[model samples]
Target chain A: MTYLNKIKIFVLVFMFILFTSSINAQWNIPADAKNKKPPIDPTHTLVKTGKDLYKSNCASCHGTPGQGNNIAAIGATDLGTADYQHSHSSGQTFFQVEQGNGGMPSFREKFSSDEKWCLIFYIKSFDKDFEISGEELKEQKADLRLSLVEKIRTVKAYATTKDKSGKEIPLEGAEVQFFIKRMFGNMQIGELVPTDNKGMASIKIPENIPGDEEGKLNLLVKFKDTDTYGKVIKSKTIKWGSKLKIVNITDKREMWGSLHRVPLWVLFSYFGMTIGVWLVIGYVVFQIIRLKKL
Target chain B: MSEVNKEGTKKTIGTIVSDLTRPIKNHKGFTIWILFLLTVMGVGMMAYVDQLANGLGVTAMRDYISWGLYISSFIFFIATALVGMLISAVLGLIGIKWITPIARIAEMIALGFAMWAGLIIIFDMGRPDRALNLFIHGRLQSPILWDVTVVTTYIAISVLLYLLPLIPDMPFLKKAMTDQAKWKQKIYKILSFGFEGRPEQYKSIKKLIRILAILIIPVALAIHTVTSWLFAMTPRIGWDSTIFGPYYVTGAFVAGGAAVMIAMFVLSRNYNLKDYITDFHFDKMGKLLVLLMLVYFYFNINEYIVPGYKMKAGDDHHILGLFTGHYAKMFWTVQLGGMIIPIILLLFRRMRKPLPSLFIGIAVIIGAFFKRYIITIPTLVHPHLPIQNVPEEFHSYWPNAWEWAITMMAIAGAVLIITILAKLFPIMPIWEVAHEEGITNEEMNKYVKES
Candidate 1:
C-alpha cells in the first residue's frame, strides 16, 4: 500500500510540473525579441492611432482601458495592469499582437509595422513605468503556400520569408492558424500549430461539420506575423466532401420544424365543416336559380 | 285594401308601405349626415395618404405593441358584423316571429360590418400591397387564414340574405314610385326579374332563405371563433385560453345587439316608424342586450378568474395589469359602465323604452370599442419577455391622430354602406311584414302545400 501511494504521489507531482511548464510555454519569447526595442516613440499621434485601433478591434475581447473582459477570463492577456506590461518587452508585445495567442487573431495583415509599434506604445501607456528602445524594423516580404492534397480532408501550408536580396528563407517558430469561413464570421477549426524547421504546418479537418450549401469549404491558412516574416494569408476552396442532401421543400410538409404539423383531427374538422357549409350554400344557390324561372 | 281596427283606426297597405319607405326618400337631416360622414371619410383618406407616405410610423404603433387602433376597430367591426347572424339567422332559425320587423336592418348591418372587417385588417397591415401574399402563401393552419375565409363566407351569405327577401319589395317600389330616375327604373327592372308574385317564386325564395339562415349560423359562429383563434393560437398569456372562442362570440352578440338597437332607434325616430319599429321591439332588444351582456360577463369571469387564481408566471403580469395596473381604469370602466350598468339598467321596465335603449346602445358601443382596445393592448404590453431597448413610447400604445382618423373613417365607411343600402332599398321587408300581418298574396300562396 505504501509503494502504491508513493507511485500515485509521483504521478500527481509529475502532472503538476507538466501543466505548469506548458502554461509557461505559452509566453515563450526568444532572447532577441525580448531584448529588441520599439522603433517608434510614444508620440501623441501614434498613441491616438493605437487607442482607436484598440477600441475597434481589441476592446471587444480585451476590454476598454485594457481592464480585460470575460474573454480575458479565459486566457486573454490583460494590458491594464503593470503585471503583464512590465513583464513583457515592447518587441515581445509587438510580436504577441502580430501572431496572436489562443483566441486572439493575427493582426499582421491588418496593421503595418508602424501601426503595431504604435499599439505597443499605447498598450505601454497603461503601465506608468513601461518604456522601451529598439532598432528600426526592416521590411520583409513573406507569402504562404496552402494546399489540400490529402484526399481533400487535410490542409497543408508552407510559409517563407525573403531577405533584402529576395532569397527564400524558412520562417520557423511562427504560429499558423487555420479557419473555415462561416456566414457571420470565421470559425477556428484546430489548435494553433507552430511551423516546423521546414516552415510547414498541417491540420486534419474534422468530419462532422457541415460545409456550405454546395458542400464546398473555404479553408483559410494564415502564416501569422513573425519578427522576421510578414503576415500572409492563403485560402483554398475545395469541393471534396459529400454533398448536403438538398431539402425537397416541395414534398416536405409545410411546418416550422418537425414538431408542429397540421394535426389530422384539425384538418378533418376543417374540411368537414368546409364541405358541409359549401354543400348548404350550393343548395341555397340551387334554390335561388330555381327561383329564376318563377 | 284598408281595414278598420277594433278602436276604429284605419290601417291601409298604402300607408304601411309609405311609412316604411319614408327613410329611403330625401330628408333634411339625411343629406347633412351623409356630408358629415363624407367629411370624416375624406379627412381619414388624407391621413391615410400621410400614413402611406411615412409608413406605419404615422401611427403610434411600434415593435412591442404592433397592433393599435386599426386592429381594435377590426375586432369591433367583426363583433358588430356578428349581429346580423344573431338576429337574422339565430332568431329566424328558432322561429322567433317578432324579429321579422328588424331582420332586414340586421342583415344590412351584417353586410356593412363584414365588408369593413376585411378592410380594417388591410388598414392594419404595414404592407398592404403584399396582402395578395395572404392568399398565395396562405397556410390552412394559420388562424388568420381561417378568419379571412370565414369572414368572406359570412359576407357572401349576408349579401344573399339581404337580397333574397328584397324580391317581394321590388315590384311594390317599382309600381309605387312613378317619379323614379331612369337609372333607378333600370335597377328596379333588372333586380325585380319580372316577378308577377308567382307561387313557385315565393316557395323558392322561402326555401332559399331557410337554407341560408341555417348556413349563416355556423359560418357566423366560425367567423368569430376563428377571429378569437387569431389571438388564442398565439402563445400570449391572457389570450391563451379555451374560453376565448365563446368569449368573443358572446361579446360579439352584445355589441351586435347594441348596434341593431341604435339603428332601430335612429330609423324609428327619423321616419316616424313608431308603428313599425315599436316600443315592444326596443324592449325585446333591451332584453337581448342584457342576456348577451350576462353571458359575456360569465365568460369574462372564466377568462380572467382561472388565470388570476394560479397567477402563472407570465399571465400574472397580464392579469395584474388589467385588474389593478396601468390598464385597470379603462378595464373597469368598460366592465362596469359598458356592461354591468347597462345590464342592470336594462332590467327595469322604463329603461327598456326606445329613448332609454338608444342611450344604452350608444354607451354599449363606446364601451365595446374600449373593451376591444383593452383586450388587445394590455396583453401585448406585458409580453412573456420584458420589453427592453425599445423606445419608452413603445412601453405603452396610444393611437395617434392619424390612427384615430383612419379608424373613425372605417366606422363612417360602414355607416355609409348602410346609408346607401338603406336609400336604395326599403329598410323594412314589406312582403314579410305583410305575411306576418296575415295579408298573403293569393297568387303567391296558390301552390303552397299544407304541411
Candidate 2:
C-alpha cells in the first residue's frame, strides 16, 4: 500500500512539473526591436486579417488565442493572455513571428511585413487591457473597376470613391492585394501595393502558372485594409496562363476505383472463385435431393 | 482407437439409441438453458432496437475502433466453427474412431456457430437498412465482398457436411423420437428420407460425405482465410502481414479445439454419456489442443517477433503496444495464459482428464476471446497517423453495455443453437457409434426395431 502510494505521489508530482514546465523555448530579440512601434497605428482591418492568417500558420501549435488549448507537448504559450501581451512589444512580437525558434518555424517568407504586424496586433486584441491606438476610418462607398491587358498579362485596377452627390472621383493611396484563386485558398501574387495618384494600380501575372484546359485563370483583387477603404472586391478570368492537362489516377481502371473501373483480373478471379465454390456446393446439395428421390 | 472404451463393456443397440435420444423428449434443463439464452438474446435484441432507434450512437465505437465487440464476437464464432471441419474432414478422413462420438458434437458446434456467424455481422451495422448498398455499390476488388461470398458458401457447405452424415442416422432418430413432439418426429422422418436399410443409400451417404468433406476443406480454409483478408487487406501495421491468413487460421483451430473440449466435458457430464465421450477422448482432444496451440503459438512468434525484432517505424508502436505497452496486459495474458499455460497443463496426463481439461478449455476460451479483441481493437487504436483532433473518448475503446449485451447475445445465440440441436437430436450419431463397435449395415438397418 505504501509502495503504491509513494509511486502515485511521484507520478502526480512528475505530471505537475511536466505540465507547469511546459514553458515555451525562450526567444531573444534585440533590445531595439522590443521598443519599436508599428509604422501604422493598429486597426481592426489589420487585426481581422491577422486572425485569418494566424489560423493557417500558428493555430496548429498555439491554438485559438484565448482558448488555452495550445499543444502542450510543443510548449506553445497562450498568446491571448494579458501577461503575454504586456510582456512583448509590437516589434518584438513581429520579430518573433517573422523569425521563429525551435518547434515554431520562421514565417519570414510566408507573410509580408504588414501581415506580420497585423498578426501581432490581432493577437493583442484578445487581451482586453492592451490598448490599440488606431482611429478606424469611417465607411467609404468605393467601386474598384478591373481591366485586363491581355498582351502584357497585366491586370489594371482603378479605385474610385463615390461622394454623397453620387459622383465618382479617383480614390488615392488605396492599399490593394492581388491574388490568384487556388483549390483550398488564395495564392497571393506580387507584393502588396498602393494605388498611385491616378487611383490606378497594375500587376503583371506570372507567365508559367497552369490554368484549366482553356488557358484561363481566376484572379481576385481586393482592398488590403477593409476598415480603411471598405471591403470591395473584383475578380475576373484571364487567358494568360498555360494549359493544364488533368490526368487523375482514378480515370484509369485500378484497384481503388468503383466496380466498373476495377481491374478485370480482380473481377474475373473473384467471381470465378465465388462461382466455382457455389457450383460445388450446389452439386453437393443436389446430391442430397437425389438421395431423397432414391 | 478400439482402446477408447476404458471400461471395456459392450452395449446392445437398444440401450445405445435410448441413452442418446433420451434427452430429446426431456428438456427440463433445456427449457431453463434456452430461457437463459433467450433472456440474453432478448436483451441483445433490445440493445439492437435501441441502436436502430437512436442510431450507432448507442455503440461506443468511434471512427477509430469502429469494429468493436460485434466484429470480435463474429470472428470468434468463425474460429469455433472451423473446428467442425477440422474434426470431421481432417481427423475422420484419417479413420479416427474416437471422433465418432465427438464428430457430431463438433458438427453441431460448426452448424450452430456458422449459422450465427452470418447474423453477428449484422449487429455491427448502424444503418443495416442500407445494407443493400453493400451489394449495390460493392466493388469486385474489395475483400469485404469476397468475405460475404465465402461466408455464405462456408455456411452452405457446413450445412451439407452436417446434414449428410445425419441422413444415415435419421432413421434411428425418427423411430426413437416417436415420444418427442409430432413436429420434431416429422422432421426426423422427413430427414431420414425413407432410407430403410438400403445398401445403395449407405454407399451414396459415404461418397457424398467424402465429397462434401473434400469441398468443406477449401471452403473451411477459405472461410477463415477470407476473414483474415478483411484485416490483411488493410495496410495497417499489425494487420499488414502476408502470413496473416495462416496465422489467423491456426489461431482459429486452437480456439475451436478448446471450444470442443468445453463441449465434450459439458455433454459427457450433463448427458451422462461417459461411455461415449470418454476421458480417453478428452485425453486425445487434449493432445490435439496442445498441438493446435503450439502451431498457433509458432505463428504467433512469427507474427510478433519478426516485426518486433525490427521495430520498423509503424510496426514499433503497434508491436510495443501489444508487447509491453497499453495492450500489454491483454497480449501477455492471452499468449501466456491461453496458449502457453494450457499447452503446459494439458501435457500432463491428469490435466487431460475431462474436468481439468474443462478449466483449461475455459481459460483458453477466455484468452481466445481477448486474443481476437487484441487483434482487432489494438490495431485501430495504434493507427499510423497519430490520434489527434479527436475527443479523448476516441483514444481508447470499451464496448458499452449495448455492445457487450449484443456480443453476449451473439455468443449465447450460437450456444443456444448448439443447445437446441443437442436437445432435439441424439448428441451421438446412432448409426456411426453402433458401427464403431463393429456392427454391419444390415444389422444397423433394423437395429431401431431389433433393439
Q: What is the C-alpha RMSD of each candidate to the true structure, in Å?
A: 12.3, 12.1
Candidate 1 Cα deviation (angstroms), residue B369: 0.8
- The prediction achieving the highest lDDT against the true structure is 2
In candidate 2, which residue ranges exceed 4 Å CA deviation? A1-245, B449-451
Whole-model lDDT values for every prediction:
0.81, 0.85
- Name the TM-score of chain A in model 1: 0.45
Candidate No. with top DockQ: 2
What part of the reference interface contacts, as a 0 to 1 fraction, does candidate 1 reproduce?
0.32
Compute the interface RMSD for candidate 2.
Answer: 1.5
Write the residue-wise lDDT of candidate 2 on B1-451 in tens digits.
2565767577667777888887676666777888899999999999989998998878999998898988988888899899988999999888887888898899989988888888888878888888888899998888888888888888888877778888887878877877667888788888777766578888888898888778788888988998998999899989999998998899999989999999999998888888888888999999999999999989998999899999999898898888889988888998899999999998899999999999999999999999999999988988878889999899899899999988888889899889988887788888888877767788776676654
Q: How closely does chain A match the true chain A in each prediction, as TM-score?
A: 0.45, 0.51
B185-254 per-residue lDDT for model 1 (tens digits): 6786677665657878887788888889888888999999988888988888788888889999999999
lDDT of 2 at B2: 56
User: Candidate 1: misplaced stretches above 4 Å?
Assistant: A1-290, B1-10, B443-451
